[model samples]
Target: MARYVKISSLGPAPCVIEAGGSAEEAVERMIAHWKRMLGFVLPDKPDLIVMPEACDRPSKAHYPKEERLEYYRVRGNRIRDYFASVAAEHGCYIVYPTHMQAEDGSWRNTAQFIDRQGKLMGAYHKNHLVPAEYDANGILYGKDAPIFECDFGRVAAAICFDLNFDELRLQYVRAKPDLIVFPSMYHGALMQNYWAYSCRSHFVGAVAGLPSSVLNPLGETVAQSTNYYPYITATVNMDCAVLHIDENGRQFAAIKRKYGPKVKIHDPGLLGSVLISSEADDLSVRDIIAEYGLEPLDDYFNRSLAHRCAPGHMEP
Candidate 1:
C-alpha cells in the first residue's frame, strides 16, 4: 500500500504594501501576490500546498501599531476566504498562516488548515511566542498541539518561533503525526532535519526568503527550492518505517530479494538505521515488517531499556 502524496512549498518573499494604503487595497495586493505565486505550483496538481508564516502581512510597510491592528480588523478573513476558494478549486489541502483576531478579542499567530472542500479543518496556533509578540503585540500563546486528519494522513504544524521549544516538539513526538508542515519567517536549519528524525515523520518547510524543502523520515532532502526558483514540488510515500540495521541486516537482504524493486531500503550512511518503504500496490511497510519479523528502531531501543531496567539486571 503506497500512500503517495505530492506536496508543494512556496517561499516567495513577503508581499509589499504601501504605508498609507487602505486596508481594502492592501488585502487586494496580498491576494494578487499570492495568486501569482500559486500559479507556479497549481499546475503540478499537488495534494497539499504550504505557504510561509505571516503570509498575508506586508514586508516593507511601516505602519504604526494601532494602524496595523486597525488594518487587520478591516482586512478580516477575506484573504483566508480567497485561499479557501483556491483550495477548493485545485482540490488540495492548504496551510494558511497569518495573524488572526479571535472571538475573545485576543489575537493569535496561527496556521490554519484548509481542506480540499474549501472548509477549515483545524488550526495550530504558535505554542511558543517571542517576548515581542506578547509585549509589543497582543498575541496570546497557543495552549495545545492538535493533529489534523486529512484524507491522506495525519498532519501537524509549527510556526516560525515555535521550532525552538521542546515543549511543542515533545508533544508532536509522542503523537507521531505522519507529516509536519512548517510555515516560518526564519529557517530552523538543522532543527528541521532533527525534528523529522526525532518524530519519525516527514517534514515540509516553507520559509520566507529562504529555501523551502521537503525531507523524508531519514532527514534527507528529497526536493528543495533554489534562488532561481521560489517554489518546489515533491512526492513522498507515507507508508514507511525506520529500523536499525544491526539486527535487521539479513532481513533487509531477504526483503529485497523477495520484493525486488517493490521495496526500498534506504541507508543514510553512518546513522546505522535505514528507512524501509513499500512501493508495491499489494503490500504495506507494516506487512513487510510482520512478514520478515523486523524490529522497528524505536521498539528495539525501548526493549533494550526494559532489559537494562529488569530486576535481575538493575544496579544497586
Candidate 2:
C-alpha cells in the first residue's frame, strides 16, 4: 500500500554573509537570501518544502567564527516568521533549519517545522554536533531524537552532522517515522540511502552545494536535484507494503489484471523488493491484499519465525 505525498528539496548553496554588518543587518541579509530561494520553488504545489540545513544563515564566511552564533540568535525569530508566513501563503509545510537558542539558553543547530496554518509545530535540534559546532562555536548537542506528527505522516529531522552518528539512526529505527527530513550542509552520499533503507522510511536530503535527493525504502534514488536545476520536486507514496518473494509472484499478474491501473506494482529489480500502492482514495493496500489473498512481505517473514530453523544447514 502506498500513501502518496508530494515533497520538494532545495539544494542551493546556503546564504552567504555580507561584509561588515551589524547583527540586525546580517539577519536581514539572511532573511532576504531565504526569500529569494523560496521564490525559486515551483508553484507545482508540493505538500512540504525542505530547505538546506542552516538556511537562515548557512555560512559565516565574512564574519569571525566567534561572532556567528550571536549574530544568528539576534534575529532568529524574524527568520522563523518569514518562513512561517511563506508556508501559510503557499499552504504547505516548511522545514526551516537555522541556529537558535533553546530554553536553556544554549545555541543549537535546529530545524523547525512550520505548519500549513503558519503555526510552529515543533523543532528538532541536531543530536550530533561537529567539533567546530561545540568545541569552537559552543553550540549544544540535542538530547533526544524527536518525531513530529504531520497531516501526511510521521516526520523526523536530522541536521548536517546528525547523519554521521549511529546513535541517532538507531533511535529513529525504533521510533520509525514515515519520512525523514534531512537538511544538511555536508553532502553525505551513500549515507542518505543507508539511513533510508535501514529505517525503512522515505528520505529527503536538502544538501547545500550538492544535489538534493529523495530515497525510498529499498535504498533506491527515486528523485534528485541536478547540476543545472539545483532542486527537485517528487511525489512519494508513503502508504505502501513491501512484498518479498514468495507465493506473491503468482498473484502479481492476476492482481494487476483485476485492478488494472487502480493498483500500482513497483518492482525495483532487486529480486524481491516489490512495492505496492493503490490509486483509489478509499482503497488501501491491506484491502487489496485481503481481497486477492496476497501475502504482505513483512507478514510472510514474521510467519517464518515459527520455525526458527533454516540457517547454515540450508543448501545453496
Candidate 3:
C-alpha cells in the first residue's frame, strides 16, 4: 500500500536574542518566533515537521560561559513544553532540536521526537560533535543511534555535524529506516544526498540560514525551501524501493505496463538506478518487486562482490 506522508521542513534563520535581555524574555521571544514559523505550515497538516538544529538558539549573540549556562538554566524545558503543546494541538509529530542538560550536569545536543498526541516518543542525542561543542560548550558526545517508530514509518535523526561521519551513516544503512531527519546549522553540501542514496531512505534536511530540502532515495531533490519561503511542505510516498537498472530494466517496463500510473519509476539519470514507488492502495513496492523478481540495488552489489571474490574470478 502507498504510505504517503506530508512533511514540512522549516529553515528560518536563527532567532535573535538581545545581548542584555533576560533569559525568560529570550525564551518568550524564541517561542513567539517559532510559533509564527509553524503557523505558516500548520495549515498544510503535515504528518511530520522538522526544525533546524538548535532551533531556539539565539542568532548573532555572544554569551560568556557563565551567561550561557544561566540562560540554559532559565530556558530549561520551556521551549520543549511549547513544542509539545503545538504537536498536541496540531496532532502531528515534531522534531525539536536543542541543547539539553543531563542529570550529571553535562549537556547534549539533542533532537527530541514528539508523537502525534504530543508525547515524547524518543530523542537522538548527536553522536558527532565539533571540538567547540565539547571544549567550549561543555557538551558530551552521544553513543547510540536509535530509530523511532511512528505511525507513518520508521524514522531516524542526524544532527549537523553527524552528517559527515560514516560510522553513524553505516549504522543507519544497516537499520534501513524509511526516513532520515537532519536538523542542522550547516548545509552539509553533497553529503546530504549521499546519505539518502547510501541508506536507501528518504532524507529531509532543515538547515538554519540555508535551503531546507526533501530528497528521495535516489538522492534527487524532490522539494526545497526557496529564498522567498523559509519553509516547504511536501508529500512523499514511503512505500518505495531502490533497484539497480542492470537486471531490472525489463522488470521496470513490465511493472509500468501493468500498473501504469499506479506506480512511479523515477530515474534520476546517470545513477544507473531507479526509485520504484507504489501509488495504488492494493499494492506495495515490496509486492511489486516480488512479482517482478527485481533485484534491490544493495543486493545486486553484494552479489557482484561475492562473484568477484570467487576462486575462478578474474583479477581487477
Q: Which candidate leads the pack in lDDT?
A: 3
Please give, for residues 1-316, the per-residue lDDT of candidate 2 as tens digits: 4467889899888577765578888887878877777677747688899988877774666666656756866885888898889889889999988878767777888898999998999999898888888887678878877799999899989998788999999998778798999999897888998898778789999998898999887668999898897888899988776777578878888888888888888888855767787887778888988887888665676777744555754457
Judge candidate 2 against the unseen true structure and give its global Cα lDDT, from 0 to 1.
0.83
Q: Between which residue pairs do clashes occur in model 1?
A: 1-283
What lDDT would candidate 1 get against the real structure? 0.91
Residue 22, candidate 2: alpha-carbon lDDT: 80
Please give the TM-score that candidate 3 achieves against the real structure: 0.97
Q: Which structure is stronger by lDDT: 2 or 3?
A: 3
* Candidate 3 least-lDDT 10 residues: 60-69
lDDT of 2 at 288: 88
Residue-level lDDT tens digits of model 1 in 1-316: 8999999999998886767778777778888999999999999999999999989888745655655676788889998999999999999999999999999999899999999999999898899998889887889999989999999999999998888999889899889999999999889999999999988999999999999999998888999999999899999999999899978888877888899989999999999999999998999999999999999998998999999999989879
Model 1: ten consecutive residues of lowest lDDT: 60-69
Deviation of model 1 at 202, angstroms: 0.2
